[model samples]
Target: MLFRMRFIPLFFILLSVAAPQVVAHPHSFIDMKMSLSAKQNKYSSINYEWKMDPMTSADIAYELKGLKPDDPRWKQQEAIIMANVLMQDYFTDFYYQGKKVSFKRIPDSYHLEKDGFSLIFFFTASFIQPLPIANSHVEIQTYDPSFYVSMTYPNIQQITLPSEIAANCNVSLQEANITDSMRAYAFSLDKNDTVDEDLALGKQFAQRVDIQCP
Candidate 1:
């Protein structure tokens, strides 16, 4: 559910951190397909395909509605989106054995295009250390903390597992566990301010995938 109703003004506010803040609420909805692939039996990368809801796309396109596809406006918008996401670690989190996995590479080159009325973003977040098959259990989640944008995984069956590994691997999706106190605190922020990361309000509401290789 979208917490806030105002769209255009809120969109611009989120684009610029320096802009006047409002209580953070979702103005955009994203359907995501994420895949985990391995190279030589080690986890290599996490790829993302995000499809923005048509309404959100139209909201973002409001200014450049008539611009040519080759216009600099499109490029500028794409750059802005990339910069924002990069600054936020691509809205992704990964863990192995309860420790966070640091992403070593976030490529500058990404695919952005207008798919019918919606906008699509595709990219991969790579890690410096490949997760060994012996790791056995790993978890990955993606979300935007402030709730300015809500991200949902379209299907758990779409997630890929390491094929070359000897053990049987299974993938499962779990709903985020948001507590009453955390929920109350999250809504209290105004001007786009977010609760402390320790509360994990967004993560608690995000779609999480648990990988087990036995």
Candidate 2:
């Protein structure tokens, strides 16, 4: 009996070690909106708002439930969440005249609120140097490259530009194309699998806001 008990524990440990990794999927959905404001014909900042689905909100709450905002643990958890998101470049991209624009730093302050059953995140990512909108073409896209979290802009009207720039620019929405090969490859991905090295994969799957000025 003693030998059998020891062997049983060892067997369970080995089984656990040999078990496959749990691949993550899109368990969270977000409805997103973006806005751009200009000052003196230069782009001032880009603002973003996101509303997470109830399931995702509930899952997130489960970990920090019962902890007040003032609690150290609560603050720590919030910091960790922000850090991870920032590490992903806030899941945003911008293009100017066919060249990519990179952010110099992440937003230092943001707002989080619980609205009914959903959790909302609001923040603004500022430009390192204001982009002049005069006679220039620009495009913006927001997406998760890993495909583990699905993001969508439900309303085309959610994208807004300042009144002055609106007159000089034309704005349109471009739907992302998911090719057959990409779809099949994405479907075949498992937990331990990494996405293709093609950095443009996110842009291919991301809805783009195209703006042209003359």
Candidate 3:
């Protein structure tokens, strides 16, 4: 049964002290890896990278839709998102776990493509994170700096905290769990950081999420 839309921690995204602001997205989990290649006019093939085995792929297939509250696919998304939040909170409570975060590394890159105004997050793990990619629909508070919205290829946009979100980035998936389902992430502007470090965190988070799906 569809319960009351309890977006308690879903709508507002409270960044760390470095990014002292909260925002929302019309689409959940906008940031994800995917691979895609068109074969003439046929349906272009797409897949998620985290699908290391067979079981996860079967489960993630439906939850990534981020459909309506009562839509048949809503429950699936909810379960996956819920599981992600639990995992994140668990690891985030203290500090770093074993391998930095908790995601597993895979050999394949996720196959993805553009769809209308969303950046579709497809993976071999059996599920896809339906993202609106054409136009930017994200918002950043004034206190936050360094923020960028990408309308191009994957790993294209890099938004910094304290940086105002463009008028284009004004979307937060009203249908999906913003905190758990969002592809967007937060980080500091320290030069000491590396892309792979962030990638590791993202991978761990994604891995945690992939395991949550029923």
Candidate 4:
């Protein structure tokens, strides 16, 4: 059974202190890295690593204080975090040949660790149906729809592919095109403010990963 959602409090608490007065939409940041794995010419699973910024990490650490790895509370905390991401579809938009793709959660793959002052979340999810990659195009975008948190891959090298398909596939990163109006809009919102969910403010600033295999 999935754990009850307890991450909201943590999220809101972090956001409350993430920015002062002038900061824009993204109050917290997560550095992301992903690896794509394949089998029998079909893309199968994606492994994700998200490194929380120091401020966010500190908040999380305080919440998890004195909890040992073997503590049941540790697992509960992990489940809560995983559920938070699952509620958002893992913050991923995947497409194959222009059609949206779905994913299945791999609960056993969820884990967390500390990296210096940062906290890193690690998880894996498989496509509901593996997507064929031979002579096909695939696109993946990850972002926080609410724009409260900024998720980004620091560089193109952060994304990796299975070696067997690496040579056959051409990959590129498309940076988000943030317009002046968009910047202004983000700037106007304070930490307590929220953008309409329908607006998908974060998607406007999402970086896209495009892949083609010939």
Residues 1-214 of candidate 1: C-alpha lDDT, one tens digit per residue: 1112222222233433122443445545789887777887788788888888776666555655777657887666666666666776778889887788987655525666778878787777778788776646888888877565678877776576655652477788887777777667655656446456676656677888898876
lDDT for residue 157 in candidate 1, whole number 0-100: 66
lDDT of 2 by residue, 36-138 (tens): 8788889878888888776556645555567777777656655555555576777888988898887657673666666777767777777888888888898
Candidate 1 lDDT for residue 96: 81
* Candidate 3 global TM-score: 0.21
Candidate 2 wrongly placed segments (more than 4 Å): 1-25, 64-77
**lDDT over C-alpha atoms for residue 102 of model 2:** 72
Task: Rank candidates, TM-score, best first.
Answer: 4, 2, 1, 3
In order, candidate lDDTs are: 0.68, 0.67, 0.26, 0.80
- Model 4 error, position 48 (Å): 0.5
lDDT of 4: 0.80
**On residues 89-124, what C-alpha lDDT tens digit does candidate 3 reach at each position?**
311211111122222222123332224333233332
Per-prediction TM-score to the true structure, in the order listed = 0.74, 0.77, 0.21, 0.91
Worst 10 residues of 1 by lDDT: 1-10
Number of the predicted model whose lDDT against the real structure is largest = 4
Clashes of each: 4, 1, 57, 0
Q: Order of all candidates by lDDT, from best down to worst?
A: 4, 1, 2, 3
Candidate 2: count of backbone clashes, pairs at least 3 residues apart or interchain: 1
Cα RMSD of predicted structure 3: 19.9
